[model samples]
Target: MPFLRENSGKFSPEKIGALIMVLFPLALLLIRALNGSFTPPTPFGAPPGLGAGPGLGAGPGLGGVDPALGARPLVEVIRFIGDWAIRLLLITLAVTPARRLFNWPKLLIARRTLGLGAALLVGIHFTFYLIDIGSLGMAAREIVLRIYLTIGFVALVIFAAMASTSWDGAVRRLGGERWKHLHALVYPATALGILHFFMQQKLDVTEPTLMAGLFVWLMGWRVMQRYGRGTGLANMLALAVAAGVLTALIEAGWYAVATGVDPTRVLAANLAFDYKISPAWWVAGSGAAVALASEIVLRLRPLPVRRAARA
Candidate 1:
């Protein structure tokens, strides 16, 4: 197969890995469609299993159900898959910023594929969500009016616009500056997506918090790049601010977990005051502070000069 051919004259592990990463999800979907095993396989012959046996109808076998639950197993599975797909997309976007901080420039190549895959997964997720909503005999207007649905729709539209122009041809046509300007839409798209999740989630804000932190880190890098690493007093002040923010967020998160309250809901509902804090917020804030401190120290510390002798 042309795909299997190693044409780069180097080890093709990355090429092979990339292909497998792209195909594996689709392969799983195909298997699920054919076998009707929406959920992951359980322990061997475990009760309420997805095996091909008489117990299937009793809720353990393929398509087995009580019929009164109103929703199929397949539908639930699709929703779960879609949720995780968006989460993966957010993580993929973070990869670039993370790599840059670590000085790994080669990671840039994988960013486009990761982004496109995220868009594809989100598109599939929207399709499934729409299907499920329609199956309930609900009006399209009702679904659109939902906060989560509306935000999700906006996020998808942004992703679609970006994805359409992801190719080299589109980049050339738009010019690099214009293309980059357009791509900045990703920031809002991610924010909307996080909002959607924050609204839809029942209890934990862990995932949304992590995504928010990543966004902060990515954006902070840009700020640092713009401002020459601040002077001694400026750096101290910046680090102090970061430390205070981190401490507050950590304390709030701890309080929420202790009281069994949902931090996401608190933030979403009370936009005016009482900002929600999460572990991710702390991690991002503290990490950025430390990174900034390191950068400043490295820049200020004079390096030993090498002496050159002319004979």
Candidate 2:
């Protein structure tokens, strides 16, 4: 990746990674579209907003439609976009942590690329949401009035602001300190975006839970690293363990309140291997892998002093 190589040209690894981020999601959408996933609930060329308004029961709002081209497709498409948007957002967040933990300073080169890619995904996600609802007028009203939509809209606005200011010209015009402060809005933007995802789901929160756990780990690692607790195998492992436990607790608490279920059962599920791996284990394993890879890289790279002496 150009991000990894200092002397690389236009097709840098970082640029490639960012391109993949965009193309992969676009490919999925294309596949779904070709498979008729974007087919409307009404006829193929139905006029805009005939009977497909929010309350008409043919869109994402309430009423259901034909099985072949039902509202489910719209939901699936919106969700597909939303999921990728959140993943890219997390990937953008991970650049700093990965750069610091792995001693790969060039990783910062990809941060803007990933961030802009995420903003694009969020933009597409919102556009699909509007298309799914079938009416710009009703969609605008719903976005303004609906709690979940409002939250998502706010997150998208934040993304738009950040993306707009991502260029060097914007930085110079805004001043470095002001730009940094303005861009810090990403923290809340990501949080609200994830919460919007969680709230929109009526069931099967495994993915959202996993996303939330990862967000915690990425942010937590940054905080720990900022405090001079330098990256090491032991520290990374500890943080992973703590993050895993926190994930379990968060899932348990969510279920406890949302369904009045036994929190113990949720906690116990994390230990049982028979069932599919839980989010906590996934988070822990990912963190551990990063730690292991960092250690391997550190050990393999020759010391700066030794390299200079040899030269």
Candidate 3:
């Protein structure tokens, strides 16, 4: 009901919009379960079946998800659900920046719904993992023994905590400041989510790199705001540069530490225009576009008449 009702107990446009946002992905899952034509995109040149390994298969083990139906590859279906969880989580983080940039106070209503929806999807993602293994005890042991799984589990726990406390009564009990500080764990939770994603990749890491870059941009903006550098054009552009460089470093760093690749070569490959544009450039371009849009919005804002009396 919170997804459909505004804070004032009225059914407002923002609430309706948030409900739509929440349900759309579930519908996508249903479609994927019934018809596999709408499979989520894979990273880079990887085939759809690239990572279809163990614990993911077209069998009767899907805990009612019925990944066995349709052409939905079990691994891809699960990955699709998990990716949407991350997407929703990222969108939740983007809401505040977007509201501030566009001067849309109504946008705040969607944040709770978005965050909780993301939590729900993550719950489902984990549920599918359980189904894949077909045993809770085994899954528990795996989650305990596997570092990547542990990272994802911790992130899920954070999301669950935030979701449980999203109500007004909980906020009253915890106090607004304390509640906010508790929810601040989302940043690190998301970092863990990204790490889990990268570590699980058997092939291309293009999507994980891009998602991490976007997270970097969001955090950069938050840091700028904290330092009183307002999200002005110059500051935003500078943040974009920093985020891009950091993104490249992140990609190169992962390759260096996780694989036998040369970090310097990977980092330098980002500047190779002759090949594909790296995820770093995409993140920078996305950030620069947002900065330009904010600049335009500021300039186009209505000017106050000198003779106008104070309200």
Q: Count clashing residue pairs per candidate.
A: 2, 6, 0
Q: Which regions in candidate 2 have their CA more than 4 angstroms from the true location?
A: 1-10, 37-71, 302-311
Error of 3 at 232 (Å): 1.3
- Score residue 48 of candidate 2 by CA lDDT: 41
- lDDT tens digits, residue span 82-123, model 2: 878999999989888777555566668888888988999999
Please estimate how well model 2 matches the true structure, expressed as its whole-model Cα lDDT: 0.77
Error of 1 at 156 (Å): 0.3
Q: Considering summed lDDT, which 10 consecutive residues are worst modelled in model 3?
A: 302-311
Every candidate's lDDT: 0.55, 0.77, 0.78
Q: Is candidate 1 or candidate 3 better by lDDT?
A: 3
Top model number, TM-score = 3
How many residue pairs clash in model 1? 2
Order by lDDT, highest first? 3, 2, 1
Question: lDDT for model 3, on a 0 to 1 scale?
Answer: 0.78
- lDDT (Cα, 0-100) at 246 in candidate 3: 92
